[model samples]
Target: MSALELVLLLVLVTDPFGNLPLVLAALGRLDAAAYRRAVVRESLFAFGVLLVLGWGGAGLLQAFGITQPALYIGGGVILFLLSLRMIYGNAQGAFDDGYAADPLLVPIAVPAIAGPAAIATVILLRTQQAVPLSQLVLGLLCALLITLATFLPGRRIAAWLGPRGVNAMEKLTGLLLNLIAVNMMLEGVRRFLG
Candidate 1:
């Protein structure tokens, strides 16, 4: 896939727009400055995690005896399941809300921002495509940057989009993700059969 496609997919899976309410709730008690700082810090931390997985996840998979086909199929299945949640509007409750008051990283950085779906998708792209490491890194950075931008002004965006609008976008993105998941699975099956 092209760098643009990778970045777009990454952005969709990251789903910052959809997670606006969650972030707001987690950091709601904080002052404006603290909120901004938390947003930047947590996003950067999440980016660090994704970068690590994108860079070394293949070796980790190999160490675990996972083949490329298995990675593709697994990632595709996970993404597909996530998309189903999105499409059915059940994704709003899909993540844990057990974040502590004025949370820093646990829910925001780990599961919300760099969740399993995002991590799996990045690892899958890095392994499945012959895209250069530099390009993959660039794509991830670009996507994360967009996610950060959305998060910084998350409240305003959420106000503009509202809950219903965000849900609509989530469903649309979910449909696109479902299509990508099917393609990934089909490609994996073809490669495995060969």
Candidate 2:
């Protein structure tokens, strides 16, 4: 894939726009300055996690004797399920229950930013696409920068978009994800048959 395609895939899996409400809920109790700090901190933490996974995930897969086709099919299935949830599920209340008073990184960074789908995509890019480490790092950086930009002004954007608008956008993102997932699966099947 081209660098732009890699970045776009990373951004789609990151799903920053869809996770705006969750981020706001996680940091809602903090002051403005604290909120900004948390956003930056959590984003960094997420980047670190994704970087580690992207670099080391291939080794782990090899250790388990997993093949490229298997990884592609599994990743596609996971993304497909996530897209269905994004399209039809009630994501607004994702973090409504069992959240810390002063959240650190559990809800926002891990699942919201560097979730399973994102992690899987990073690994797929590294292994399936054989993206160079430098290019992968650059693509990840670009994607996370876009996510961070979205998060910094999350509240204002949320207000401007309104709940309904946000929901609409999430569904649209979901539709895109579904197409990507199907393509991934098709590639996997082709590889397996070949």
Candidate 3:
């Protein structure tokens, strides 16, 4: 894949737009300054987690003797399921509002930004795609930056887009993700057969 494609894929998996509602809900109680601080902090934390996973994922897979084909298939399945959820389910309703007034890093950082789908995508990009580590890291950084940019003004963006607009955008992203997932699966099947 080209560098742009890699970055786009990373952005899609990170899915800042799709996760906006969750982030807003999680950080709703905080004041303006606290909200900005939490968003930046949690985003940084997520970046660190994903960076580690991207660097070590291949070694971890090799340790387990997991093949590329398996990773491709498994990752594709996971992405497909996540896309389905994005398309059909209520993103906000999926999680509970049980967070404290000043949330730290549970929902917003881990699962919201660097969730399983995002983690899987990073691993796949590191292992399955032939992109160099440097390029992958750069792409990851760019994607995260884009995510952070979206999140910084999330409330206003959400307001402008409104509920229906946000939902439509999420569904559109989900549709694109579904295509990518299928292609990944196909590539895996071809590699296995060959």
Which residue window of length 10 is worst by lDDT in model 2? 90-99
Which tens-of-lDDT digit does each residue in 1-194 have in candidate 1? 77778888888878776677678878878888888999999889988898899899889998999988887888788878877877886554765667676776778888877887899887887787766778878987897789878888887877898878877877887888888888878877887999
Structure candidate 1, residue pairs in collision: none
Instruction: Return the TM-score for each candidate structure.
Output: 0.92, 0.95, 0.95
Provide the global lDDT of candidate 2 against the true structure.
Answer: 0.87
- lDDT per residue (tens digit) for residues 1-194 in model 3: 89899899999988888888888888888888998998999989887888899999889898999898888888889889888989998677766768886677878788877888888888888887767889988998998789889999999999999999888988988889899899888888999999
For model 2, what is the alpha-carbon lDDT of residue 26? 76
lDDT of each: 0.81, 0.87, 0.86
Error of 3 at 163 (Å): 0.8
TM-score-best of 1 and 2:
2
lDDT, candidate 3, at 18: 87
Q: Where does candidate 3 clash, by residue pair?
A: none
Weakest lDDT window of 10 consecutive positions for candidate 3: 94-103
Pairwise lDDT winner, candidates 2 and 3: 2
Clashing residue pairs in all predictions, respectively, total: 0, 0, 0
